[model samples]
Target: MLIYHPAFDANHCLYRIVSILHSANKTGVSWSLLRLLDFYYLFPAQLKEISPWPSQISKYKRLLKNIPQQYEDINNSPRVFYDLEKFQKTAVLELIAKGIVSKESFEADKLCLVDDALPPSFIAYMKSDEFFNKDEFKIITEALPMVGLNGPQGLKKRSGLMEYIYDA
Candidate 1:
């Protein structure tokens, strides 16, 4: 069986993380793809800048502390995307804006992989022992598949794609 190491392949890690978050959240209330990217790339300092209010910062900090196992930050700086060649930031933004999955999504979900932002295999691998603990796997596996073929919608519009996603 193939195993994914986030330290070795951060791009795949980001992709998988986004898909997992999207799948795990309930339908119609799923996090936007931009939000997932922020969760992965935005450092604590960046978060602080955006969350000026103490209560908001505290709430976001708590949320960050509870991120999935694969995303646990040990060092001071939070991990950020460094896969500009294989996974260009621009391309990913386009994907989120257009709901177009990369060719890699085919490896994650054969059917509707190109159309939907989240794929079945992405969730499956995340739930596998390769990344998550048994309890985490069980919870993630159970919740991720409750919805089908759902993609992240534009945070502004509430339903369809947004023409532009503001740069962070």
Candidate 2:
């Protein structure tokens, strides 16, 4: 069984945190992408700069606990491409502006892996509960079928998800 430790820069991480806030607020959000939503919905207000850690920690943490599926495939790129297209330019630009991330990697949803594990506690600090747990919005978790996944034995091969061993 493979355990996934979502990285700080991962779209899923932001989505998990933001969606929890949206759900708390009862906001009708059906989209899978969020960084764009963060810019459109939380930025300018500087919600991303939430001090002392984002206040939405508990909520985001709760939403993050929902991931248990291991099903994956090679075509997982579409979900990220279409869902995050709007934010691709903006988020990457912001990262570049902040010097937090490199620009070369932002052109595509080209996913990466975090070698070291990260706990969710630090994530709560990115924004305040106001944006993380907004009362009017709600969040839903989505997966990119093959995000950062390597074929069996790390070989350049694709295999059936049914063969995946849970708790491996």
Candidate 3:
């Protein structure tokens, strides 16, 4: 019984990771944060429910309102998150192998994009409307600021997707 799912698709995961690193800009994202952010990128509905909303919810009102109902809320997020861990790691490794991301940087715990490694066309596509869901990507961008404010532990707690208490 062959199975096909975006969550298990290497190319899909690779593209998503690239888009994430690109949107993340110069100060690359931490490995843990990348995992968390990728989760939301894959499941925007979960992002809407789990994100730490600002005091001024109006800031995200439009984006939140735009999320289509097709992405129904995920009930067992923790399990799904854990299940995708291996595939996520594989995608990161593929990035390093492809030289799009540096192994040294990833080893140092930050997934930094390699300068000029990606083709200009690819970069343009990432920024264009043709990329995955525009609203979803925007939501990921909007949620990035919280990475600094909450870090991995706080994000895990808020998402209820991991055991952060014992994480050092």
Candidate 4:
């Protein structure tokens, strides 16, 4: 749903998605940055905000190949469905601070696993109450195209300024 928000900042988007991964419980899969980018832009809404330049997209793909994806190694898998620690990066943890990385874990220096699943908490947070409702859906649907995810135009539609933008 994030592709075309017009206001989509790649760093912010990746940061949020990474935060979601930190909370997941799955152990069998890992998210390649390229794969995650495709997933985000895979949806219609996500691309609406993305620049169409191939070079820009490729630059991000290159980062996935080079950046560190794993936050830490699992000592014992959590029984819970979401293993929130999986996706935490040093920067993100510092930003929110539940307690910085386990000092022991850092000194232990074990092999870390990359998180594959997206966080449900974030997905739910992104969804709207009017999501499946017909009337609101109609309004949002009608609103997306005026600027196609590029700026204040998309924001206006999502925000209650659609009429103003359209009429202006």
Candidate 5:
């Protein structure tokens, strides 16, 4: 039987990446933080559990409070993160190849949007409540400031998604 998982879908990963970078704006975000945020965005229950909530409260607090319970795949998160690694790389590479995201920023350990503005359609879709869980998106965007509070190593340590001690 064929199975489909968002973790393995390049297009879905691409869309998520774009949404993240867009939320990040021109300031850009470190690759590590992006990966962590991506994981949370994909598995919101995990996000709700581990998020530095006091430091990054969303304006949509009611939405977060009322958020429907999602499966908490905490035990599999690290494995899922690793499993999604290749697809993430693929999505990043495709973005660079298409000139939508900056290769130089990527090489420098950050992911930055090359264009000041995404195509109007993409922007509309990204902003639309119909296409995305608006509350989740708001939460993720609100969390962007945490990228500065923790360096890549610090964020990795916080997430426990990867062994950060030996990371260079």
Candidate 6:
């Protein structure tokens, strides 16, 4: 299953994944691996109206693929299972390649570990005057609910708290 998004590339996905992992590690939150995968898979759908690249509007318009009704119904849907697995692997590989994240423990139950205490270039990229002032954080914040981590006990407290500090 090849799942690609017009609004974001491997860098974009890696940025999100790393940011989540970095925040979770900092906050000591026990985020669910399953929820992380679902968030990445459903991210593109959250930005159906906005194109990351404005010049290529038509390309982005075509890229707004419909999100599955049930992101967590992977067990009953083989296609969903395959897509999520593939996307998660690809995103993780990108994170590793960029040195933003590392597998803390591959055991049956271990959260991902931040590879570096220092911030990655992606974070710098996000903070660069050109992009940072553009309010990309607003888009990311808006997409939180669609990513399915907006519930009170979900990632809102963890990631949201981190975002508040990060934005400040």
lDDT by residue for model 2 over 48-137, one digit each (tens)? 222222233435434433333334332543243344445544544444455433334333443221222223564455345454443223
Scored by TM-score, the top model is: 3
Least accurate 10 contiguous residues by lDDT in model 3: 144-153
| Among all candidates shown, the one with the greatest lDDT | 3
> Candidate 5 on 10-122: residue-level lDDT in tens?
89999999988887656777776778778877876565454444433444445566555675445677898888788888898999999999989999988999975478887
What lDDT does the true structure give each of the candidates? Answer: 0.37, 0.33, 0.74, 0.31, 0.71, 0.41
Candidate 3 ranges with C-alpha deviation above 4 Å: 1-3, 51-58, 71-73, 129-133, 148-153
C-alpha RMSD between model 3 and the true structure: 2.9
RMSD of each: 10.7, 16.5, 2.9, 19.2, 3.2, 12.2
Q: Candidate 6: minimum summed lDDT over ten consecutive residues — where?
A: 159-168
Compute the lDDT of residue 98 as modeled in candidate 2: 54
Predicted candidate 4 versus true structure: per-residue lDDT over 73-156, tens digit per residue: 324322211222233233333432333223333334321123323356754654543332332222223322223322443332
On the 0 to 100 scale, the lDDT of residue 76 in model 5 is: 71
Candidate 4: stretches off by over 4 Å: 1-8, 19-25, 33-168
The C-alpha stretches of model 6 lying farther than 4 A from their native spots are 1-8, 25-82, 97-99, 106-108, 113-121, 127-168
Looking at candidate 1, the ten consecutive residues that score lowest on lDDT are 154-163
Q: Is candidate 1 or candidate 2 better by lDDT?
A: 1
Clashes of each: 0, 16, 0, 13, 0, 0
Which model is ahead, 1 or 3, in terms of lDDT? 3
Per-model TM-score versus the true fold: 0.31, 0.25, 0.83, 0.21, 0.80, 0.39
> How much lDDT does candidate 1 score?
0.37
